[model samples]
Target: MGSTPRRSPRRRWASLLGATALAVTAGGALACPAGAAGTNVDFATHCIPPAVAGIPPIDGTTTANVSVDNTSPKVGDTVTVTYTVVTAAAGNPTDLALPADIMTPTGKVTLGGAQTGAVTVAGPKKNTPVPGKGAFPSFSMTGTFTVTSPGAITLSPGDYNIHTSYILELDTPCTVITPPAPVSETVTATSGTPTNTRSISLSSASGNPGDSVTVSGSDFTPGATVTLAGRSGDTQTADTATATVNAQGTFSGALTVNEPTTTGIVAYEGSAWNADLGAGPATYVVNDTTPVPDGSQKLTATVKAGTLSMSQAGDAVALSAVDFGQGGAATGALRTVTVKDFRGGPAGWSLTGKVTDFTGPGAKIGAGKLSWTPVCVTEAGSPSTCAAGSAGIVGVSGATLASTPDGTLTGGEFTVDAGLSLDVPAFTPPGSYSGVLTLTLT
Candidate 1:
């Protein structure tokens, strides 16, 4: 204009203005242009919201707390893990599709869903609704994870993030779960007592040799053995619970007291707990003896040349005699005798005859001859005169005796000497005789 303003090209004028602006903002961006220009080009940036965490609610009592052990999981080990989700911050819901993730990919991570050989993801709904205030959304899920790799995995100990955005389509953010607290429990055994008890006594304290004494005791076991000692007896085994104590306890038989003696018999019982009889042994005493004959003496008679004779003379001719002295003596005696017959037998011989008195020698009077005489003699000798010629005799006359096979007597007689004068003569027979005999006790 003043010199015609030196006219410039249009493209050259545009390039010059862009080069001047690049130089001014080379190291940094340019500040908004003054007032009206900045108002026309407004700019801003937005950030993703933080995820929330919460502990899952437990149904039952927490046993102590969840403790992480050094147990490496195997293929078929039954594993039960419990967890609690706690919300750190409150805003939008956290999608919990995959609650745990395998960082090293050593094993498959599973959640609350049906399982297969491959890795599984499970939990509450992805895009779970979260409240305005910080909320402890509780959840529990169980599944098994299998190790596909051989060695251990090197993983840092920290909260691992679960990518729920890939598994489920959701608008809410996802978060890592924290471990739970630790806990412990106890265990115990018991037993019962036993059941068991013992009975035994003597029936009688005194008994004879052949007497049976009962041993009364209860609960005697089968094949229980009982022994009775002290006396000359033997032991006894009970066939049943009850047994008879014989005189002797010897042998398997009854006890028998054979000999005559006074002894105490001890009964010993044996069982499982008790061995032999101790202080409480059952005892019994036995006593016995042979009986003695009364009012008799043992005697033996000798026959002279197969002949036996006896003479007696008294108020009544009598002889007292006895047999083997087992019973008493025989009491009456024969007066006189005449020979009827005579013989001998196995035991001895006796003579059978009749009794009569002689008035004189060889005197035959009445129906028969009086072959016997009676005599009476006293120490005082007071009666000095006889009936006719001599004094009376106080004893018996001659009597002969013999025996036969049937115990019959024959050819026996009572005889007197022709020259002998007597008042009443009494003759005593020797040895044992059971017939009868006279007695003269002055």
Candidate 2:
């Protein structure tokens, strides 16, 4: 399928009511006091789901309950915010089911009054299966929003987007309408203590090259431009991402890992000590991704494997001897050969065989007299293919026994078997003749 064209972001906040003021941020690691400050905000949200074929846009109210761990936080204190989507306005409205690995809800909450910054919240992915006729799953997102300074912070609902991407790109732009009050919640901050900017984190600790990561910074000067420098060990890499500090002194932006880069990052307000950041930066690990065999989703492993090889079962095969006095034909089963491909690459492999002339007591029989019927079988459930060689004499020129063509994976074990036969002539010299059979795999 071709790439899906992106639709312009829909503007829906203006028409909807106030959203449940939910603030989510990364805060636990920051130093904060044990506190008794809280806010419970409840409100309804109206959303317009993406338009798909044969399914009408779902129109309903999504109720949410939000809470902050500490409302009376001091300057530079980290407070936890939890937003529970009490229920979804609608279920999977499309005829098709949304796949399992789709990401979950992530939205922003706006603040007014004394505090004037926004908090970003995101939930986890890999949710349970939502059947074609099942209801949309309910979810809860929890994170921390850092308190930058002393003020009476008022929370309000902000414009947020949701994704369902199945037949078309899954997108739902939502707005908060008709809340109990204009402000869904409030957080009062006092000028208790001041802690300089010194904390930073990334939404994803690791990712593949060309993948993007979110950089978060707290306690920075409001409206200041924070420079995000990718760090390798103690040295800064060539790549850098930047984010502007909001009115509340918090910032977040995306950084693309163009190469296999180390984790550490330095977010600072340029050279001067405008903020305490860059004093000692924390690192973020972005490792390279490995391609799996047979289109598997095993991306976490970094494996360096060996090449293709072949082994045969049993020592040798002894065909029924021809007595010459009653000569007719000598036949037996060829030894079973196993081929293993571990080259990691998609280039396939081939197995061919040839045999030398039979020799007995200074007399010999032509290798052309030997012919075989070949058979091949791939291992059970293996995403590879093996083909039997043409039934004929395998002489010096050699013939293919089994092969997995190029452009396809030939991983795992595959067996190549053959039924061997030798045409014996009358009065032929046969004193337990033995010949070497050579099999080559590449």
Candidate 3:
């Protein structure tokens, strides 16, 4: 604060007279009139009152409070401390400079290589208030103490003192006011350490797409967020699942191997994180496979002269009477053809199927008119593109079978589900027509 310019003695007389009269009426302060040139007045004797007869002088009380960011501190962990001092006083503004120290259970603490302190004021507030000499002032001082020692550092809650070098200035004479008693607060320090080890485990060692697997763990920091992720060979994906460590330091939740995940061993990793404890990670595994939920990839080979073979899922496919009736209506049963690769090298194979014209009786149905719709099936129990087909379904020109890798041998064998349908014109002569559906694989 900048000081006001000094006024000449003659110019100060009127204001001084009025201030003296007011001070005398108030009775707390002594009254003194401005002196004449070269005639000095004993200002302290007249303006500084020994003591007020009735009203008690207003004074301030100091309080120290502390809080720690992390109650459990561990190696490599830095914690923060918030210390605040509030003084309640309603009187003339008294400027006080109070020193504060953060001490461990054993000794005092220094943050940023310096001692901390709180300066107090009078009234009911600390910051900007209605400014005037008689306005009761109240204020508070706060400091952040950072503990970077990593290990255990006890936080003393109220082990501090509010020392006052408080000074009071008046209209004529300035008198220093000192509290008769020393004010200090005794406090207890709280300390903790982080030294818990974490471990994780999976419910099972393997699973298929959409299979539910339990992820369980223990010894993690309480209330920490844990995320689970999975990786298969070169492909990585995040599980849309997470768990929070409970008060007992344990976590458990069910996560699913997302559908369409690659057929391989998927390695799962989970980690728990907290602001104070950092991160702890663990790993597990899930073997994701095909048609069979086989954790072990055991491929038993059955060799034959052919590179591919086709067979119906159940008995021979039986077409209903409408399929053979006269309206050009087509109908048949669904049959799955299992194609096995005995001739495994990397060279691809193709399947071409055709039906011979009905020849069992006097009249026949043209074989070329028959059509088949085939959907390729993958080991993952889902429909996939055939290795060598455009429409994938066979027409009059005959459709080519599709295999993975275009031509090379991928999984030893694959299955294809095909629907057989025959068309009969309404005018066509009909006998018990019988035709052989020939599916040749190369």
Highest lDDT, which number?
2
Candidate 3 lDDT over residue span 147-237, tens digit each? 2234333332222222211121111111212311121221122333534334444454334357776666555668867665454423446
The numbered model that scores best in TM-score is 2
Predictions ranked by lDDT, top down? 2, 3, 1
RMSD of 1: 67.4
In candidate 1, position 358 carries an lDDT of: 24
Give RMSD to native, each candidate.
67.4, 26.4, 38.9
> For candidate 2, lDDT tens digit of each residue in 290-374?
3445755542223333445566565545667666666666777766777776643334566776766766666766777777899
Backbone clash tally for model 1? 81
Structural similarity to truth (TM-score) of each candidate: 0.16, 0.42, 0.27
Tens digit per residue, CA lDDT, model 1, 1-442:
0121221111100000000010001112211110110001111111123323443321221111111111233322222221222222222234443332211101112121121121111232223433343232433211112222223321111121222222232222222232211111000101212121112333343344566644443333435465433332233222223243333332122344443342333334553223223111223344322333587532323221122223323223232332322423222322322211121211122222222232223231121222223332212321111111132222234233322221111123323111111122222222321111221100
In candidate 2, clashing pairs total 15
